[model samples]
Target: MEDSTHTGALLVVGAGPGVGMAVARRFGGVPVGLIARDEVRLRAMTETLRLEGRTVASAAADASDPTALRAAIGRIIAELGGIDTACFSPLPPVATIKRAAATDAEDLLTALALVVGGAATTVRAVLPGMLARGSGRLLFTTGSGALHPSPERASPAVYTAAQTAYIDVLRRDLSGRGVAVAHVAVVGPVGADGHRPEDVADALHDLADEGGSTVLHLTEGAR
Candidate 1:
């Protein structure tokens, strides 16, 4: 395992496309750990990184599952020492739009569980060593939901609430703890020309490297 802070192992929890890929590429040349539920996407990203001659690894797991997530993190730590920065962007591709009354209770609960629970899982898995080592970066992605939560889209509204709650927790409790916790809220659709997942990823790692102990509130800085 390589020391992430020292050697630059950026663990991208949701390395699908858009912002996730953008972040991964921005911090080029460092060993990167890409985590995602989709095998194809993970493989594609991993291959791209490897082709570019950068150290890369991939893991398939549901971020909401703490045990599974931790296991994956362990593998990453084993390969890259410890994670210098982690970007948590678990946005589903399809629009999860559901009318308030028609919303599925189970689905909504699961979404909330994954979004918030995964944030906690990812942080907890790495926080211990990061704290002890006295350096790390923890960042999460929030889109339109964080800025303007809609009650009409009940499922998204719920997810947004949880995402915001997690960001607030990071800002309040974890910001100044040697490991800088930052929030990048892409208020619009995040993509290549937009404020995509990769965009958030880049911000996360860059801030982590800066290590200013500042709580970044990037509300759509660049798309």
Candidate 2:
């Protein structure tokens, strides 16, 4: 199916290479707003999309900081007119990864702040506009560790599972409200094996355009 075109703005949080960039490109037909912690990288990505003849804007903020993230989202919304679709895929820091035996409370808390907390903050920031307009799409991407526990990746597993549940509840509450929510679980390493970022982007695009299911699992060999 051809990717549906969006007339309103699309916001990509945790915007960077791989999945984030692929999403931005996939939805480049609309005014694209990007949010990431690295100002330099965000500017570069914005410029890259602009060079492609896309209407692009960017803001720098760490998703873990709610104040910063909200401000960034507001700036993007002001610049792009309003966010009609928002995609969030913030990866937890490497230090947060630890085996179950080696994991501590602090590690789990940090992961929660970055993964679940960040997603919630992003949702809160964009939801008002979506609700006011009576239409919007909230898309999220996480690792399959969300569904299958990984002893070696204890922190991620805990927070991603929480995030998955959060998205599920959001979908349940938002049903018949005109706003769509979907989560995509990536089963393997992106850009390796047969799993590509573009394929994931396509799945996300589908979810945003066609809101049938609340969750989708993107494996290495499947779309």
Evaluated with TM-score, which candidate comes out highest?
2
lDDT by residue for model 2 (67-110), tens: 99989998988888978889998765679888999999998888
Provide the global lDDT of candidate 2 against the true structure: 0.82
Minimum summed lDDT over a 10-residue window in model 1 is located at 210-219
Which regions of candidate 1 deviate over 4 angstroms? 1-6, 93-96, 196-223
Give the 10-residue window scoring lowest on summed lDDT in candidate 2: 212-221
- For each candidate, the alpha-carbon lDDT, in order, equals 0.71, 0.82
* TM-score of each model, paired residue for residue: 0.83, 0.92
Give the CA lDDT, 0 to 100, for residue 186 in model 1: 57
| Model 1, span 116-211: residue lDDT tens | 888889988888888887787777776555456666767776787777776676767765567777765555555544554554555565555543
